[model samples]
Target: MTRRILLFGATGYTGGLVARALLERGEVPVLVGRDRAALDRRAAEIRPSDPPYTMVLDVHDVGTLRRTISADDVIVTTVGPFHSHGRTVAEAAAEAGASYIDSAGEPPFIRWTFEKLGTRAANRGARILPGFGNEYVTGQLAGAWALERAAEMGVPHRLEIGYFSTGGSLCSLSRGTIASLAGSSLERSYTYRNGIRAERPGARSSSFRIGGRKYSGFSIGTTEHLTLPEVSPSLQELDVYLGWFGKASPLLATASLAGPLIRRLPGAKRVVSTVGARLGGFGKDGPESHERDRSGVLVSARVFSKSKHKLSEITLAGPNGYELTASLMAWAATVESHASTRSVHRRTGVLGAIQAYGLGVVRDTCLHLDVREVESAVVSA
Candidate 1:
């Protein structure tokens, strides 16, 4: 079995961006998707590299997916609303002992990966990671930074990692993203409560006025609430919030009210979900680099000790969502590829970016994100 990466959903919007980033960096992955022509065109568009091996299959087509990968290969998937489509790919990768990574953000699905799929992947000698992209990595970096700073304190500690995305006025998402959020609205948001994975039902809200901007935060389901605890096991509490929604609180509140119905009535959900397709990447274009720069997330994490001491604070302004996701998947894939087989084999089971690559590499490799730590000034890595 040859060592390589099988990039699933290479034809989708975020997937295409990952493909280009990979190609631009003089790397290649076996592009996988349901559309053969689109995959071929994408392969052709990339710079000269190893002839791409393409696989066409639906997100749930695990039987066929198994035949396309090997133990030495790693699967990087972008085909999501992960709650609906992530399990199959994860299962197939675990069964085959093929390493796996995904751009999954939905908390329900991410919790499913770490709690349910972690053992499965490990049993088969595979290393699986969810939320390796925009949805969680930036937050993970902030958390990891705090932990490292506290480690510098040289004391026993119980800490907390709070994740919130600050701004995105010019930011917009694809129909796919909107649809995912709409679907996840019905699924129970999850977190590690009292050192255990627990379901956080209903919508959790946050209100804060910072940097001359008012934030009405929405807990729209994210993996960070779960994964960050594993990264820093001493972390006693974790809250993941979304202030980037800005004025959309009323609409989200309505969704919260309708969540019970969405779970029970399929038709009602269908009608509401049309908003996702309309508002997402359907007809509207995504933001460009400059536009994204003007509107990126401020991932702020405060580090505290068991005695309620504020040890240190970590802050990072990540790149645009789409670009951040693409860069992360590409960079993680590249890191896994260059790593020794023994190193990979030792990393079996679901892991976060901090656990998989460490904060040093995450900060170093994701150069596009600007990071600032307390008393540290602006450091590149």
Candidate 2:
């Protein structure tokens, strides 16, 4: 069978961007979605030299979804608020033994991908990669690079990653992202301390100094908690933070301390989900090209020695989150489609960005996407 790339949710905002990116690279991905008209419109907009094949099927229909995917196909999905809509598609890919990629950032969904689906996918020889987007991939690469450098000094015990963005407002986020955040706001997140441990979102706060300015972020669960430790065995603790809220981060952190109580309130989850969605502009089309272009992202990863002294730090600066996400998914899908590259790594099951593609390749890809390393420091004892 001829290997093909399948773009699910191709009619959505990020999916459309991924489609365009793939076409620009001279690859024609089959657009798969429930709406034929939207898919047709997207295909027309891209105007690939070859008439792009389109598949119309409800992703919720597990039977059809499984049938549609093949072992030889690479599936890129952007349909999310993943905790709600992502499982069916992900399961189909795992069962079909197809290479799967998604833009999920929800902590619970990510955990489920690794803890529940990891073994099943591995058994089937499927490579399941969650958070192959800006939400976590950028930080994962940064953390991996830091771990590599810190290993030279001595065994590292702690890894901390911070994500910051500039020149963009909340309007830059897609409806899907907003909804995902809303859905997961009250859920318990995890971190790596000795091992995976439950933690309240925003329960901890961290600050980083970059370019001589201070940025503060609230702690959150990320793929880094699961993947970074594998890069360095001596790691005893890992924390990932998001500084997008800026001055509001402390307020958010304070509110999060009551998470356990608030979550227990009758109907609290539904209430928060609804309010968050509306407040976040869940019905909008997200920011325009100019707005996205006006934004940039910075990710910092710092590794510390057993004695609690910082050993190494790596920082990467990149384009807007959405744009980089689309580009990264496209680049990853292309790489997975090639048999030679797949064989070289031969990685199966749920994987972190570094595990899916080695640190060298991820670093090179970041450079190509203008996500160059802006700083690297190795401190002496």
Q: Specify the highest-TM-score model's number.
A: 2
Error of 1 at 348 (Å): 1.3
Query: For candidate 1, lDDT tens digit of each residue in 339-375?
Result: 6666544667788877777778778876644434433
Backbone clash pairs for candidate 1 read: 174-280, 174-281, 175-280, 175-281
Report lDDT per candidate.
Answer: 0.69, 0.86
lDDT of model 1 at position 225:
62
| Stretch of 10 with least lDDT, candidate 1 | 372-381
Poorest stretch of ten by lDDT in candidate 2: 372-381
TM-scores, all candidates, are 0.85, 0.94
